[model samples]
Target: IQALPVSKTLQLDLLLGTTQRFVRTEPVRPLFKQLLEQVGAGLGEGQGLDAMAARLAAVEREQFQPFEDRHPFVWKNLLLNEFAYAMFPKGGAADIERELMGIVVKFALIKLYACGLMAHRGADFSLDDVVRVTYVLSRAITHNRRFLPNLLQTLQDHDALRLDVMTQFVL
Candidate 1:
């Protein structure tokens, strides 16, 4: 474990790429295609949305969900997880608030991008139409989930990184 250095990013791309590439002898082409298909399906169905604007209407609802069943971290803690704590520094309630904010923020951005892509794909509804339906009921944006992202950005602009600010969890 000592040989591994902490990373600023969630390291999603690098970490996933490594597994999808050299680690497997089958090559990267198939995995890439699968990834694209997964994204396409989500956009097409107006479902399976991720870190984006049109999601998490019931943030607190999802929080209490079972991890195996759905979003389990809602209203829960992130820091108690050894893996995440190792990646992010440390904090208390404020840190958890920041983490939740980040989750909401990411979901909003992803929803925007997905809606755009889905609209461009010649789906029946216009992008605006889609947004109207999606965003109207969205609890995240209504609650100003953007503040979380803005806070993170503010901290980043100061040339300092918070212990729990780098896409890691808080407890």
Candidate 2:
């Protein structure tokens, strides 16, 4: 995947709030860097989606636990913002958002799978599973907007009580 060339202004805007009140970007920068390092550690050149998924699934929760525990608010906010940006269009940044959404979805899926909530056939997890997990996670991440509600309902309609249970279980 090509790295999104984030402008300094946009980077600052993301780390610091757009509002009048001053927000610190210094602390957030290292966190972002650590996130990038964690995500990129296992990726290799010319790898397919299956390879990517396998690597991600193999990632231990401990790798992310410290970050999540230390900065829960910032972590959640970053994820929520990523989802919002990915779902909605930002002017002149459609490409960036698309790339970002892909990463966020993958990361979210990995986290879910690591928690043993998702089933897989080795490196190959089903697209249906992806949709189901993403839907559940997005809902948990933000109640303000529903992402792929129709698809989630369709999945639940077919899958019986599993998805409903997942919704209850995932935090």
Candidate 3:
């Protein structure tokens, strides 16, 4: 696959580019949303994060069809495993609300990553679509789950870089 010129300035261009291809061709949003819901539901009635982590560790990995004629990929499994560990790095239980927040933020990060990857392909999303997606994610976190201030700040900090790449793509 030919890399878009803007891809050079974007980190993880190849991985994100591959991910973007899958994102464009497949129903990835639903799968990601479902997985997030399933994991969130696993924290029912104040369940401990450790328990949910253990459950995720045992769950089978999901396979997604790659773009065009490429072979299927197991990215979901990697995300699940890595996020599970990252959520509770010290191997201890966190408050259920906090745990759910972590899950929400992680999913949001993945979505953001996908958006960045789309830019790598020179696929421009409308500002309205971007606002809608941001609203949806923020609402999801604020409504049923806890808010993550740190994650929000981190995302905000990347706004300049994101805009720079988009500007480069546009130019």
Candidate 4:
């Protein structure tokens, strides 16, 4: 597989930020820490991103399977709720919503990429795969919401929509 254009520094920062955010959240913190430790232990030798992603997926599945079995859409609900919060963050300037939404989109893209990579392992995956996965995930996440109308309303409501942030998320 060809290397993605994302910088190692940016990847490290995203990983650290994600880890810290999850670790700070109560109830899930212990489980998140345990998953991280499990991933660390699984990365014993010359394993690469694929191995790490697979291990993380395995650990997450093992940990969440029972809950998932009981509440099939729990993960999707959690993700959508997070995205909704980003769209309308409290106690911050309204202008920050774009940045927060961009961050959420970035994390969502990373997840989609990881899932695609795992599913298409040894297949002829390409940048088109990324685009397709992004589209599909976006559709799935936004299916229940009137996302486009709300986004348009937000654009009309806010003076600045932060095209730079949107562009950053796109590219």
Candidate 5:
């Protein structure tokens, strides 16, 4: 977040991704430390920007988990919720969990891009193919642009969100 010349915009964008779409997972201790470092470096001279970029990039890095890909209703709930809030994929929403939802949506996008499970496209899922739920399919179909970027940006601006999630992951 500190990487941008506009520290405030970076912070706001980070907030939007977190409060609205981010999922409540993982401890924020390490994430917060990273954010602090980036912001701190940003406070300095030229080195600050580079440090901030690295820090922001670090904040935005993707954390991989083997998505079992169940929870169709949760996925559907996400779609229904996202659309209700006008964040139809790329439409955008301003709800808590938006960040997390975006993450889930991206996972589905990667799956689709790789031509993984095609059931959403009339193919069947393997018993252990990390099945994406119907809701995810809906988001994938309805909000491709927004959903995908939200996912990528989470990795891209992870430090910002990490700053928030840190409170939840109290030591």
Candidate 6:
């Protein structure tokens, strides 16, 4: 694929292919660290979305940290959730297990990207994916009331939306 210096458009194809690489080399730790770092540095310098996105887009697989230490509780919830489960394919136990691992990796990357995008005020990343994640997180909060307050605070701090607006949207 052509590697362009452009916005933070996710290379779904590349990401899907990344699962194969995980078997060979160790996965990136602090998952998506490169992307997250770039977002922080860019925003600190008061850069715009286009600039931030371009910088984020240029990150290669080698730059990412391994996903070896993510919280099991969070990942488990994400996998079993209705929205995430729909993406799983039907298969035998072995095949299902393999596919489930890939889905876990994919979701981790998505969350990494989502968190990076959320870090910056008015910074647009992949809105469709972000919204989908937002939906899942919202559902999570509903399922467990404790998450609602923390999520609201995060939204307000990130400037994704006003706390009131986010409350209505999530509800």
TM-scores for every predicted model: 0.25, 0.27, 0.27, 0.32, 0.20, 0.29
* Residue 161 local lDDT, model 6: 27
Off by over 4 Å in 2: 1-50, 59-62, 73-147, 157-171
Worst 10 residues of 3 by lDDT: 60-69
All candidates: CA RMSD (Å): 16.0, 17.3, 18.2, 13.2, 15.7, 16.5
By lDDT, the better pick of 1 and 3 is 3
Q: Provide the global lDDT of candidate 4 against the true structure.
A: 0.42
Off-target runs (Cα >4 Å) in candidate 6 are 1-77, 82-84, 87-89, 122-171
Identify the superior model by TM-score, candidate 5 or candidate 6.
Answer: 6
Question: Residues 47-159, candidate 4, lDDT per residue (tens digit)?
Answer: 55556555445533543244345555644654566567556555478656655654455444444343334333423434444445444435433452433334434433543
lDDT of 6 by residue, 63-154 (tens): 22222132335444555773455456667666664444334333544454444444442334334545555464344334444333433334
Q: lDDT by residue for model 3 over 1-171, one digit each (tens)?
A: 124343322322222223333445544346345433432453221345345333322221111111211322323443475456555444456545445445544453444433432232222433343344444444444443223444434334655224343333222
In order of listing, the candidates' clash counts read: 14, 0, 0, 0, 23, 6
Candidate 2 residues 2-91, lDDT tens each?
243312222112211121111122222333333333333433213544454444334333333543465466445545766675664544
Candidate 3: C-alpha lDDT: 0.37
lDDT string for model 1 (43-82, tens) is: 3424423332132222212321232134334223322332
Best by TM-score: 4
Instruction: Give the 10-residue window scoring lowest on summed lDDT in candidate 1.
Output: 59-68
Backbone clashes in candidate 4 total 0
Output the number of the lDDT-best candidate: 4
Stretches off by above 4 angstroms in model 5 are 1-105, 108-138, 159-171
Alpha carbon deviation, residue 107, candidate 5 (Å): 3.7
In angstroms, the error of model 3 at 85 is 1.6
* Better model by lDDT: candidate 4 vs candidate 5: 4
For candidate 4, list the clashing residue pairs, or say none.
Answer: none
